[model samples]
Target: MNAHNIDIALVGAGMGSESCLTKEVKNLIDNADIVFGAARLSNSFGDSDRQNVIDTYRVNDMIEKLEEADKDIKAVFIYSGDSGFYSGAEAAYLRVKEWAEEKKKENADLNVNIEIKAGISSVSYLASRIGISWQDAKLYSLHGREYKGRVPEVIESARYNEKTFVLLSGASDVIRLTDEILNIKNVILYLGYHLSYDDEEVMTITSDKKEEFLKGEIKEGLYTAFIQNVSPETKYLSYGIPTEEYIREENVPITKEEVREIVLSKLRLFRGCTFYDIGGGTGGVTVDVAKISPDIKVISIEKRPERTELIRKNIDKFGLRNVTPLTGNATETLALFDENNLVKNDNEYENYVREIIKNNPPDRVFIGGTEGQFRDIIRELKKFGRKIRVCMTAVTLETRNEILKLADEDTVDDLSVVEVNISKLVRLGKQHMMKAENGILVATFQL
Candidate 1:
């Protein structure tokens, strides 16, 4: 061993210093020359003798101190929770490895060794206390991540996952997320707060008192995780949201659940994909697309004023923040840029896409209400290059043939058409019967 070498060890401290420290980790920490970690975590070692502990949480500062130390020293970095589950060990390991590489490049003889030891994870502990298996739980965290675009995932988890757990922090307080879920009225929450601590509290909240429970004074404990059961076995995973769920206007056209599911299936959207629901009608497609993922941006383009308002209502009812309703003809609205840069020329649609859509070309476009400008819309999509996906739905055979003819002329390859006829149940009098909806053909064109 080099006299000037530094030996670093990353040890998971579980929840805190009060308890849950493994014997091996405790021994390694006790034998170290100097320790570094968060203030509370480092101080938890109770290593006051020789004043050898540095109670700081800065990674760069630790690296610098390790480099500046003169003598060969045993250094250990402390982290909370298990080193396997979103712990700080991986981050510290990378920084230390980079430092070791740079040092080796400078002196070729420097010796550095890093050892990682695991500890109990809060999620596992919580699951044990709740008497449930975490093997199937969906893990998520708002501890240091954005919550607006992430809530939909957790909500969907509750809907489709038997046990879904989310780590809570200042970005998305559990109470705040629960309040948002209140609008959905479908989740049953199981909470674990301050796990393994004296103040640890575990509880369950059902629909009966969820509103009042969320409204109550809820404290942020030492650590918080929740298991939400939306009963996936009994629920559809949001793609096939029923037709009657949305707020629709009298005699206004709305995409039925069956057709909407197929349209979204054809679109096959990914994360952060931009979707255009031209002739959005009741915003069913837009709402369903937005529900697919929180980060997916959806724009509803409708020329009708009443339908636009109805779309807005559906959006509000669903509590979706990723959708925008633009009221204007697709031919005209797709031409307009943002508030400050509306395109003056119809041919300047590319400029409109750049200025208004934030430089994001439509990843997928669903045309349900393009009047006679289908040819123009097809031409514009083809002009944009091969990165956009287009799916158009037509109720009449003539419209379907017209779109197919345009697709052929545009050199669009392998265009597939799926005709969907939804059979819904209706009451004829005392008994119910299947009501066959109009057979609609969905034409999908890939660029």
Candidate 2:
């Protein structure tokens, strides 16, 4: 707006100039002597006249052209989406800042003006179109070529809550990311690409069905997918089992109701919390936790090769998006904790938490069986101080004695137990009676 100066405006034309452009933005753009924007956006101008125009992927090029323009000239640099919302304006601002800094050092008499304008983002657009309440959905961008850690937390969190995820990026990584989380079941996916563009496309698929689409079952390339949880009604069985069907069970692998309730109670499992259930049995505890709190992530870890398959099946049957089935023993499976707790000084307990959860520690630790080495597992967990709640179930008096011995002492804080007796109702000619199944619950909380 200044006279005798190069005034730069970073603008977002929104999706298709017709839908996103506000009258205020249109006015500023109309008055500019020079305009710069993406090729697609630049073409959207139709027959509009302009003194000069530039097209390029990078905003720095646009800023350079602005710097070379005549003094007192108005120039508008445009980008897609809202300039403030994952648009090119952010990079433009950085380049402009650097250019301004360099100019100030050379000439105190010269001044440059820059302003960033707001626009709608694809996140909001896709959310609105899908009828998702934007207020409930968390937002993130995996399109940043420079970002790495962005998608994991976002994906995990979404799986935790079954939130509507609106991703704006290449379809190449969609399957790869899904493969990484195949253990999580009942996820619905929707991918939207080039929104508001002539070639724009959107598609919907379940995570399990992603394979069908990935195998070129769908011919579309530039497309986005919308996912929802629509697992078929589970096949009735005496108990929950893996969907794979071929998985062989060993060593009393089914989870007793008593054990599951105590595990859920102690872990304090809830939506949005991530955890690993070591030695998950029939995925009962993990599935229960996930179902009870859809936002909490419950991953089942089992070392028995046969049991691993069962865990996966159970995940699918229950439509548990929050549960992930992992196959491995305590030592190798939980190495993250081992590496975290290993320090120079054992007495440095505070450093223990700083090393573990700060780095990586399952929010809730469930020691259903302890893989035949209870002492070592308990010791490894104790090293982490607190911030991890550990629960265990013991069937034998000796194992119970060991658990009690550990709980009796403050090796881990807030240790408690629940001994439950559950009985099944057998219909005797329209009558039912209770049969008791006994189990002990041992829980210890820290931090």
TM-score, per-candidate, Cα-based: 0.78, 0.62
Which residues of candidate 2, in runs, are more than 4 Å off?
A: 1-10, 16-20, 32-77, 82-165, 173-251, 270-272, 291-297, 319-324, 335-360, 383-386, 423-432
Compared with the true structure, model 1 gives a TM-score of 0.78
- Every candidate's lDDT: 0.76, 0.63
- Candidate 2's residue-wise lDDT over 304-358, tens digit each? 7678777787767654555656665666445445554455455453344334333
Q: In model 1, which runs have C-alpha deviations exceeding 4 angstroms?
A: 1-4, 46-52, 182-188, 228-246, 256-262, 288-297, 312-356, 359-361, 372-386, 395-441
Q: Which pairs of residues collide in model 1?
A: none
* Error in Å for residue 113 of model 1: 1.2
Clashes per candidate, residues 3 or more apart or on different chains: 0, 24
| Candidate 1 structure quality by residue, lDDT tens digits, 1-447 | 244677888988887745788888888789898898888789978487854798876778888888776667888898888877777789889988998898877765677888899988888888888787888788987766677657767766666667788877741377777666545555667677777777778878777777788678788555456656554535445587878899988888888778888888888899888888889888889998988777788888888888989999999887677787876667755544344444355655445444645455588999997788887676666555547788888987678779768645856766888777779789988999998878898888776
Give the range where candidate 1 is weakest over 10 consecutive residues by summed lDDT. 335-344
